[model samples]
Target: MTNVVIVGAGPTGLTLACGLARQGVAVRVLERATAHADGSRGKTLNPRSLEIFADLGLAGELAAVGRTHLPFRKYFEGVFVNETEPFAGARRSATIPYPASRWLQQPQLEALLRERLAALGVTVELGADLVDVRQDADGAEAVLADGRRIAAGYLVGCDGGRSTVRKLLGIPFVGEGDPEPVMVCGDVEVEGLDPGAWHQWFGPQGAFMLCPFEGSPRWQLQASPETAADGTMVPPSLESFQRLADTHTGREDIRLGNATWLSTWRVNVRMAERYREGRVLLAGDCAHVHPTAGGLGMNTGIQDSWNLAWKLGHVVRGLAGPALLDTYQEERLPIAAWTLDVTSAGMAAVVKGIDTPGIGVEVGGVGDFTGLSLGYRWSSLAAGTPAGGDPGALLRAGDRAPDGPCPGPDGAPGRLFERFAGDDFTLLVLGAGTRPDLAGLPGHVRPVRVEDRDGEVRRAYGVTGEALVLVRPDNHIALVTPATEPGPVHAYLARLGATG
Candidate 1:
């Protein structure tokens, strides 16, 4: 039996498989689709997700294939209105290395994740549709469409909105749906349009957007259809898309052809009441489905898998108690609900032709879209703020551990993130003194001493002379305390059952 069975071979499931397999846990992925998908469904990878990819060593690869900077150009009936750069003026800082979101198609992102998983000696099993799932104390068994049963210690549903695993577990997906103003989205090859900027057109008919896909001739097309009295949507077709383009842009000269994929989307905002039911759990679209305005759907799911993978790794390896798994739902459910509201507001603005920027207008600034501000400060695992430090400091016990340049043991230049690349907790000691007594440290904890020559790391962490910051395997700060008082560190670990 495998250690974990992941249903649906999307970005979320594939990421979980890679994270678990990297830590020597056996993972089996089931996909209902016979082959990989195409088209640019979710194209934007926010800054937080980019940081996670950097930890996975795929940041450089994704950056090479993605477009990092694209301005949004608005047009009124084929007449230029105003242009705005959503990611403009964004610069990388010592703490935040990736400050900009990336534009890469979902298919490409999933392919990269699958490649990484294959390197770890795991492959996604295609054409294995999950029909039902049953769980007991020992383990959970998944029944496939072919009447084959597979047992695993845990099951995660990363399947899309129509999730069989979630349904089999009887999880309630409660939310509201918008009946009017349905959107037709797809990828198509077009002529008479410059591939320089993301083109948006507003007219009496409705608003339509054509964003150039990175490294491809095809562009992602999105258009809001006219309201139907009976709330019926026209099936996606090449002719229908062309008609939309002509009607919205008032330009018949622009030709649309070679449609690769097409689908109609409505604003269906929802969240699963519970992320986990016994040994079966939900992640990604299975747990939460929101509007596509903020482009947070896939990015949020990627983060969900990242957060759960380390906890599952520890529990499966016997380094932590099974109760640690409960924190996944506790920490992620609220974020999902928040994202749904933010995206729903953005969608409302879109319907009103407000030309809202990426990440929503109600949120403070563009940084909010990067997801850097997202943290689990209220989580039960995060503990102990720094002593004598300002309460308003950017770095906190539950915030993301910032990255900075640091010196390695051999005096070579290295990064703080290198310590967190693996499946182990990293303890950073910022001071010039000798390393503290780590004899009581658990085997899963890796301690590194930083000299803090120029105090760049110190400034980023808001620390004074000497401090110890315990970073979890997911790169979130777990504990912050003065070097003199290391008892809280041990106590925090004990709460999570990290100490053996």
Candidate 2:
């Protein structure tokens, strides 16, 4: 029997498989398609997603493929409007290591993750047509189209918007959907166009844009879909896209060649009522789907898997009971709800700014889109702030732990994220070297004592006095307690079934 049977080999499934595989949990990633998908679906990896890749040890390969510093040049009827680099001000700092967003096609990112998962001793099984699913308190069973049954401790669905696992589970996907398709996108070879910047043309006909990828002949094509007399969207094609480019730019010099892939997107702001049902759970587009305006679709799913992995790993390893799995839904459901609302508003803003020539309108850059501001302050695991902890503290329980300069175990210069990376719950003892007696603590809950020599970590963490910040494996602040008190620390661990 496998520890977990994950349906869908997309980024979310693959990432979860890698996380569990790192902990020696048997994970099977099954994909319905015979091969991996190649598309221009999601192209932006926000700062938070970049941090996740860093933790997975794929930072070097990911950075090499993602392009940053490309300015978006706008055109109105073939006239130069202006140029705005979205991430120009996102500079690296001690607190924020990956401040800039990286632009790469979804296929490229998935390819990198697949390679990493393989290194971790797992491969995605192709053509896995999961037809049915049944679960109980003990475990879940998956039935494939070939009349084969695979039993596992848990099942997860990451199989895109139209998910089979979710359907089999009869989960309600409640949200607002568009009556017709909204946008048409494609990947195509371009001619006579500058690849230095993302060239966009806006007109009364609608919006048209071509974003070039570094070291690739293909560019991502985006345009407002044309509606037919029946009020349905006309499917995207090479010739149809050419017409859109000509109509929007009012120029015939530009040409689109060899449309490799094409797809249409409808306005979908939806979420599963619950992420977990007994031994089965849902994530990624299978759990929630929002507007692509903020480029949060793929990033949110990547984060969802990251958050669920550590919890699921704990349960599979017997370190924590199944109650820990409940937290996965509790924490992620709220985040997904927030994503749907924010992305919907962001999409409305994009439509409102379609006729404007100024670049002041924020599309997918800045603010919460970077994902640094997101936290689980309301999570049961975070356990709320300490009894006497400041309610208005800058860094509170359930917040995404910030990065800052710190000393490593060898007393060498290093960063806090470097210590937080991997499959361990880090108990960061801040202010002074007041390391707690971790003798009876779970092996995964390791302690890190860092003296605030230059006050870098102190300032980033917003801690003025001696404090113990318990960071979860996914790098969220589990709790913050006064360093003088070790009872709360021990009690919290016991709550997590980590008593030694």
Whole-model lDDT per candidate: 0.85, 0.85
Off by over 4 Å in 2: 227-233, 359-361, 364-367, 386-388, 433-435
Q: Output candidate 1 Cα RMSD.
A: 2.3
Question: What lDDT is obtained when candidate 1 is compared to the true structure?
Answer: 0.85
Per-residue alpha-carbon lDDT of model 1 for 73-164, expressed as tens digits? 88776677777787798898878888888988899999999999999999999999889898899899999989999999999999988899
Candidate 2 TM-score, C-alpha based: 0.96
Per-model root-mean-square deviation over C-alphas: 2.3, 1.7
Q: In model 1, what are the clashing residue pairs, if there are any? A: none
Q: After superposition, how far is residue 38 of candidate 2 from its true place, in Å?
A: 1.4
Q: 346-465 in candidate 2: lDDT tens per residue?
A: 887778677777542356332388888998888888766742566887788898899987777677888889999998889888866576655676788888888886667767777767
- Against the true structure, what is each candidate's TM-score? 0.95, 0.96
Deviation in angstroms for 46 in model 2? 0.5
The TM-score of predicted model 1 comes to: 0.95
Candidate 2 pairs with clashing backbones: none
